[model samples]
Target: MIVGIDLGTTNSAIGIWRDGTAQLVPNALGDLLTPSAVAIDDGGAVIVGMTARERQSTHPTSTVTAFKRWMGTRQTVTLAGKTFTAEDLSAIVLSSLKADAEAFLGEPVTSAVITVPAYFNDRQRKATRRAGELAGLTVERLINEPTAAALAYGIQDRSEKEPFLVFDLGGGTFDVSIVEIFDGVIEVRASAGDNRLGGEDFNDTIIEVARPRIDPEGRLAEVDPLVLHELLRAAAERCRRTLSEQEEASFTITSGDRQFATTVTAGEFEAQAAPLLAKLRDPVLRSLRDSDIRVETLSEVILVGGATRMPIVRKTITRMFGRFPNAAVHPDHAVALGAAVQGGLKSRDADLEEIRLTDVCPFTLGVDNSAPDGRGGFRHGLFSPIIERNTPIPASRVSYYSTLSDNQRNVEFGIYQGEAREVQGNVKLGSIKVPVPPAPAGHVHVECRFSYDTSGLLEVDISVPASGLVRNLVLMDDDEAPNAKEVEARRKVLAALKRHPREDSHNMAVLARAARCYESFIGERRDMVGKWTAQFEAALDGQDPRVIDSARAQFEDALNQLEGDRYL
Candidate 1:
């Protein structure tokens, strides 16, 4: 069976085609959404989802959540006695979901259509694909999360023939997309986002406001750094939710003998959140500019993600486009639902078979070229966008260049992705070296072809036109790119560590509150909470899950603990 998965930063969900309808499959605890967390057990087994999250309140040091933000970097998390790459942590989460899907269907599930943020760069996308592989699932296509949400909304009526904007603000990222639906095709004209900004920033604002009140000596000096951080995060999230309706919210922090109270008005909250709100405007403006679609051309604006529930976000969006945004679908579940619909389309199990999705590239990809000497090599290292932004996916483009110097037996190409005029500032995906027979300067014809598939990853093929020599390349320009031996060693180390999903203290407190807010989290949630808590304590007893497993288990447990009805 083919399933659609939304591997979100804060929450994850899976859906499949079932009984002529798309059904979101609940995890072992009977929850539709699962926390993207892991934990390790005393028995040296990896635990994922709820169990990992429950332990976070006590085990902050071992658990690693929000690793998605470090997807393309060399960041590593250490637990027990081992270190794990972000890709490895993600794989555990993906594998856990795969197992749950298999259990639900009573059969093996091999293929899937996963959704990622529209703004994920090439490296991040590749890392996602690798995570899928580690989970034993073949990713048939990697659709943008916002695009999938649009498909779900657009296909619902089928008669709604108009252009709409999708504003997706998730826990860790924000994406804005301009789309037009005609006939049965859904075309994403342009997409833009701030990978670093999202609901989390709003929460940060709350902390900033409450910090002075809580600690007269300042947050870092008066309260325990860890406790202060967690409390601030909680306060911010609470403030963000409260501002949705009321004009004000109160924040209270208690750590040991220290206690303080602070009240933030809606206006104050908006002011603190202004910087982040401003960041959102850029993506919207960029998407509109790229699509060349005027504000009036938009039929409606759709808000996706839990963050959109904020009044400030809605107001800012309306003010920017002069239109009321659509809240027809629950922001939290829309993307997952859309993914399920896409999965149905892929499986040919839905009446919406006539619908088609055409997504676009969010950024440009190109090879760095030397500029005129007088320009101080202005374009020399600058990224010359090969595939301009908004270009359709699964698309390929080629550019030709010649050797710059005589007897240049080999040429080096520094490939980058971004719209920056200076290459040094842009992300260098990787570099490629092509060999050529001795030739006079400007004589060697080198063809550089870049292909971006549905997964959003870039494949570059460099060929010497005359010699007919070609080579396929993978981009890895980061300083941390490992040699074969290092890669193998790291893999072995990861494999040896016991896996358990567990959350840190910060998220544990957050989940505790989320559970209380959602009514559906009555039975299984209560039981899972207790069981996972015991499991976590047991792992701690022996310093078990032995590093890798413990770290993995902590993450998984955190995700599971946070899997209340609030998200779904």
Candidate 2:
């Protein structure tokens, strides 16, 4: 059976749909929730979950937690002298969850549907997939955390059409999603969030207030930064949690030869967290505006994620909506439970067959263009959106463009993802280049189509009618691109290609690189590169190695002159 896993920042959980219900699986410690921590014991064995979490207080240097915040970056953590990427630690936690699921179900589990923050970008989503692969699980899907919570709440089971909002405040990220349920469909109307703001930020706020008293002489600076941070964070977490239900709490930590203590009232704690609480408003307002739903129209504002348990957070939601928030699902368990529902749907279980889920693209997808600068030149980096954010998925959108100069032989389209008005502020996902018949400016038109799947994979298809050339590419992360052997294996699994000489592989790779470079240039430089490409192709047609090599050298020189030391 396909299990559902919630690989969260503070905790991870596994569950499955069984007997018409989503049942959470217990870990070796007989707990449904497992702390998202990893450490190495003295024996050099990797430990995950509760045991590792407890060790954070004593073995702070050897334990790591909250790596989820760095999921898509180049950040690495060292545990017991071994450096591990955020993905590596996540894979360790996922592996542990997989074992727990297998033990609970009494069978091997090979596939899973994992949940991530709704605001996670392409890189983060891809990293989550890699983590699952490393754990030997086929990641069937990556559902947005808020969307999963809505599924767990069974909004799709209701007979009437109802609109609601999910306010998710997790350990290291916050997300807000507007949802609608109608006719067996659970549709997310919009999603917006601050991936860097969450419960940990609140913990940090507490740390800021308690640090001065805990280390009056700043002696802790002599200790390892990681150790000091973990100690303070652990203490701050306790204070934050205690203040959630009580009026006051003690923030205390022990250093080498001294112990420090400070008492913080709830009001004071709330005052310090005001800034972080303020950050939560924008995402909620953005989601509401995107969905075009007013506060009065929302059927409910459902709260999920562990941080939402904070009384201060609940009060903020109440004041925002002028009504109490819904607490139908357990704050910590909702995401994993909803993930199990998705797993059931993926498996086509009898109970969930009629419940369909549709999610929106949280960010805009488009291309960069150039327009007249009104100074006898052209301005570049203009963003033209094809598929706007909040559009329902699986989605397909098309936009048209034309050659900018007379007899332009090739046109390049840079694919980007973001809400930015300029390409410089957006992320360049990839680019597509298609050859066009030489013609006057704006004479040869090209069509660019983007198709995004539910799994978040994107395929770009470019068609040049004037030249009858079509190019299709599946965009992938720069670091996650397949190697030669993996490419060959994938090619074998898909439709077979027509047989070609071995040299074609080398030629194709070069041409592909050249096409990418073509997208990076504009005006006269673009024209020059296009001409060099044509000449290189002519040399290859001669089938003479000497001629091809000479032309290749010239081609390389021309590219280097324009794009020095820049990889295409």
Each candidate structure's TM-score, on Cα atoms with residue i matched to residue i, is 0.82, 0.84
Candidate 1, after superposition: displacement of residue 215 in Å?
1.7
Q: Tens-digit lDDT track for model 2 on 1-568?
A: 8899999999999989988999899877567898898877676667677667756766777778999998877898886777777877887788888878877778899999999999888888888887777677899999999999999886335564589999999999999999888888888999999999989999988988888876788877787887677778877887888898799998876565456788888998899999988898999999989999898999999999999989999999999899999988898999999999999999999988779999999889899999899998889999999989889999999999988999887788888888888899987788777788988999998899999989998898999887788999898664454464753453342213222232343343345446545543456766776788899999999999898878877777777677543220
In candidate 1, which residue ranges exceed 4 Å CA deviation? 39-47, 54-57, 217-223, 350-352, 375-379, 436-440, 465-568
lDDT of 1 by residue, 453-501 (tens): 7656578999997899999985532445556565556556545656433
Best by TM-score: 2
lDDT of 2: 0.82
Whole-model lDDT values for every prediction: 0.74, 0.82
Cα RMSD for candidates in order: 7.4, 21.6
- Give the residue spans of candidate 2 off by over 4 A: 155-157, 479-568
Worst 10 residues of 2 by lDDT: 493-502
